[model samples]
Target: MGTSASKLNRAIMADIHRLSLNQATTERWSVKEAVEGCLRHGIPSIGLWRHKIHEAGLRESVRLVRDAGLHVSSLCRGGMFPAPTREERQQRIEDTLRAIDECAELHADSLVLVVGASSAVGLVDARKMVEEGLAAIVSHARESGVRLGLEPLHPMYAGERCVLNTIDQALDMASPYAPMEVGLILDTFHIWWDPYVLQQITRAKGRIYGFHVSDWLVPVPDLLLGRGMMGDGVIDNRTLRGAVDRSGYAGPIEVEIFNQAIWDMPGNDVLSTVVERFTSLV
Candidate 1:
């Protein structure tokens, strides 16, 4: 190898410890299969999705991860805090509590909350609902030793996916709680378009609980599932990752692409690409 190539290879190896595969990246894999894949690929950690866990049975999922001695980076979800009726709102809160328990059982680093958007109410009310929902579950999360990671989606998803659409918004929502009880989840695909992202990442500082990396495909094919693999799209992942590193977050950097094309590939092929891209691009 050339000198530059040698140095780059060394750097990739040194940083490999921080790489984690988010289960959604291999959307077709069950929880057991994901754990085995992580082991085969020398991945030190994984980000699990709730559906995969349920499909494998939570007990078996926990056993597989623990047996492999793989770290659970974070759980894929735990929040959808807006609903039209009072009863429905309470139901959402209850659901979050259950997720928290699952997070605790898995010994995951954090429970990533994609905080749902508003339909029956205005954005302002929806945000309030999110806050109320957090208030309802924060205590349980803390008691269970699970941190709630509030992930901000892109502004385009403000109406249907996530109400918290910027690092600033997520930080503001997390401000009232203790850092251990609630922290920010920075996903490059979602927050890359924000002009104040670096500044807000600095503001997040010690409160950054998780970091996810995926590219934003131009001319998006599917609104929610259009994420590209690292280096395949427009995001400057290295810069964003540097910002997160500066913010005191040294946890796993999960590759979480949601594109159908990638999902259709063989699971092992996807893992190989993820490892290569994560080392070179992210």
Candidate 2:
């Protein structure tokens, strides 16, 4: 068999117990509904957002997920580190520490971090602030036994969403942090456009704690919300997955998309499509 074929076989036989769905894919679904949907689809894992947990009530959400025997790949987000003042930055850290507590409650694999963007200063200073903020939260996460996964947003979102815009940058930030304590969330959509993707993936190796999948729309209308379904956009997730697998990081493949168009459809239909597309194309 050729490399792709061999990889496909390995992927098939590897007991893909870690396939997960992020609730953002079907925004119409409540947290309870999304958990039910994952169970219906035979997806064993999920990534949850703080808002959904709040809406569903934290205790109930925990009860439902535990009863269903679902694995939380990671919490959706916990970082918005770039603030205008020292007080605001400290507030963000405290909020993230709370998020860590929630992750522990949910028994999530890690807490995903979308490090916030620059203030009026610039990208360099903003990145520095993010690093400082992450360092501040590392001790708390360690104490709570929650691993931190830093997600690098695409450069397009660098101004507002995340200042950490490349896998290399994310790896650099996480290298000193220790893999058991903190790591990187490797997402194809954000890092696909990078020229150094493969090299960075190779370097990340064991430090890749979480893997999220989404495609890049050619003419991305809304940078934050116009995420395409896997196989519907330009990213070659199979190749990306190959690199990830080769790096010896066997973890959950969490699908996270934020397309308003898809969210308007029936939640089941959206989830069914994601499962179909992930199986056939990813």
Which prediction has the highest lDDT against the true structure? Answer: 1
Q: List the residue pairs that clash in candidate 2.
A: none
For all predicted structures, in order, the TM-scores are 0.96, 0.93
User: What are the per-residue Cα lDDT tens digits for candidate 2 across 33-146?
Assistant: 999999888788899999999998889989989999998888978999997789989999999999999999999999999999865757888888998999899998998999
Q: Pick the candidate with the highest TM-score.
A: 1
Q: Given candidate 1, what's the lDDT at residue 51? A: 87
Go through the candidates in order and give each one's C-alpha lDDT: 0.91, 0.87
